[model samples]
Target: MLPHCIGVYACGMGGAGMALATDATKIASNPALGGRLGNELSVSLGWMHPDRTMDAQGPTPPGFPFPFANTASGEQTSQIENYPDGALAFNYRLSPTLAVGAAMVPGGGGETKYAMSRTATGQMGFGNAGAMYDSQVRIRYASLTPTVAWTPSAKASYGASVILGYMDFKSNMAVMNPAFTGLPSSPTLMTSGANELERVYGIGLKVGGVWDLSPQVSVAATASTGTRYQRLDDYRDLFTGPLHLPPNFGVGVTFRASPSTDIVADVQYQMWEAVEAIGGEQPAQGGFGWENQPIFALGVQHRLSDRFAVRAGWNYGPSPIPDDVVFANALFPAVIEHHFTAGATYAISDRWEVSGSAYFAPKVTQTDPGTGDMFSQFGGGTVITMKQYGGQVGLRWKF
Candidate 1:
């Protein structure tokens, strides 16, 4: 079974105060907000679901070196109908200048399905060619952060926080083919599973200033640096080889568009070069060579009345997987381009609130036709495509 742990949400306008300063949530954003806390506590919960689809195609040439070869064309389709996820976070104020919090979020995960059947014609006698592959993955992470901030002056503040967490991942793969009944065909049937949990620990430091350019406008900036993590061995099998988690950084701006509305924009960088697989121990075979990536997000919040608010956001990043790693398993294609989100918050009472958000990632599909030595062995060629979708809901309580 896939891990049921939901991933964490980035620090966005829908959360607490610092959420207005930056959109980077996987890590701590504004520690100074902790200093403003009264003796109250806040708790939140959220849910998400992602759908995915894939397709592949190619041609089988006559007299090919492999079984099931004959000048014929073939195609395959695979999809993960529905995937579910959830998360929770809690924060409490220790004192006027100190706060502590914990959160659980989805780190990374995917699911896939593949099914194909083809008939060939020519001297090759490629009567029927078919293959089926299915795989699914789930990753969950929980973090504890203790924050401290000092407001030396009303307009200047400095804060620090440490992130300590553990990541749990589970995955399953199954493949079947009828063409391999003869001599030694490719493993006509195969199945495998990996469930490993790892720990991640790091520290972050932030410094910022609020300069009053005038009564109507103010400018602020913050900077930070943190440590990397080493994942578990079972999770490593999903990658090409041994891998490490890299450190990351971010910056953002908040603009007061009106007395009751604000606009925020942020740029974040993730060190994915350290990741090796979907969910397994250290990378196993040839390295996939993923690199550090950047993510951009923009959000706006408007206060319509005293107890209601509206929000919308957008995020984008590049694909982390390379094209040449031909493993041909249908777990994760990693070809998403952008995420669009919209959410709202309503006050149920003076100390309770309810919120929900939806994120849509346009499906990214790719088809790779087998070629060279591999082409002659698998009949003719292979094609592959992928797509995805995600959504979430949450509740917050303050006391």
Candidate 2:
């Protein structure tokens, strides 16, 4: 999953600032907060780096035609990638109690590239037909959200947004046919065969609200119907079903502990099982077998003085891939579950500010439940591990 918070303010707070209107970036998180900002603009840029590796040991069945010599015992490390992330947002008050806003930000996606060694016959144990082949997959998403918010009373604000999204996807990996028997009549080993980048467009909706419970407490919630895109004709035989983004819902609360200090907490749930290509049965169905996931975030911000503030936070979630499905998920090892973040903001003037934030996720590893049955598809002595680090810098202007 991609980092949900594209702006430095929210990233510094571990993505828990959705309930409060701190900056124009709120338009992407909870549009209701836009009404609270009279006029604001924000822009940010960042990079993400992930470290991933895979190790496997294979067994040659007594009666098999090709013994997959390259899979005997080997370890492959994924190449490091510095993926870029950025966002721009603006909010304008159309009336005393009405506001319009827009934001361009990343939705969610991942990338992986693994180098493999070929055998004497120009075929690898992984079943790729090319010599010295590398298994790789990259998927990216960008979204533009236009929102309208209304505040009829001092107690609450409501908003709605329309999401226009685009996706770029490509994959070059080996896949086994369900009925493979290593016999002459069995289906031959197949791969995606260096497909070109494919593009798709989709639309979705989001609605949210923020309510003040008292002078020092407030709560907010937001939900989105994930985008549905056109079919990837080039990948018809590579995947079980068309790929679609997953839906999500989140809630957050903010409390003022002191005049210069505030604390925030949030919970978000992703419905991966609702997507056909992501939550399908197994390898036979060409799905990832990913389970629904829930994430938690907590943050604290303290104003050191009139011109400076500091923030720190923590975020956590359980891995969505079950142990039984580890074999199939090797191509996408999104196993990191813990994140630690810190950041600071400096007000250069009454109407200008600069903010920066950084975060790191510790390494996590998972091993497959190897049963020596390759045809079962799930059993293989494969281990996958991943870790991540990233940071962002931004400038915000208020008019």
How many clashes in candidate 2? 0
Once model 1 is optimally superposed onto the true structure by TM-score, how far is the C-alpha of residue 171 displaced, in angstroms? 4.3
The residue-level lDDT of candidate 1 at 241 comes to: 35
Rate residue 259 of model 1 by lDDT: 81
CA lDDT of each candidate? 0.45, 0.77
Pick the TM-score winner: 2
Candidate 1 structure, TM-score to reference:
0.67
lDDT comparing candidate 1 with the true structure: 0.45
**Per-residue alpha-carbon lDDT of model 2 for 21-129, expressed as tens digits?**
8888888888899877878899999988888877653445566555333364366777757888778999999898999999999987888776653121113423443
Model 1: per-residue lDDT, tens digit, 1-399?
A: 111112222323322223242211222455554444443333334444444443323343344343332223233444345654555545565655445554444434444443332222212222214322223444444445555555455454455666554455454332233455543344233222322234444333444333334444444444544333454455443444333334555555567789878776666566655444322221123244344666666767777987887777676666554443222432455666576666677778877666656666676654433432332234323334444445555555666
Clashes of each: 26, 0
Give the range of the ten consecutive residues with the poorest summed lDDT in model 2.
117-126
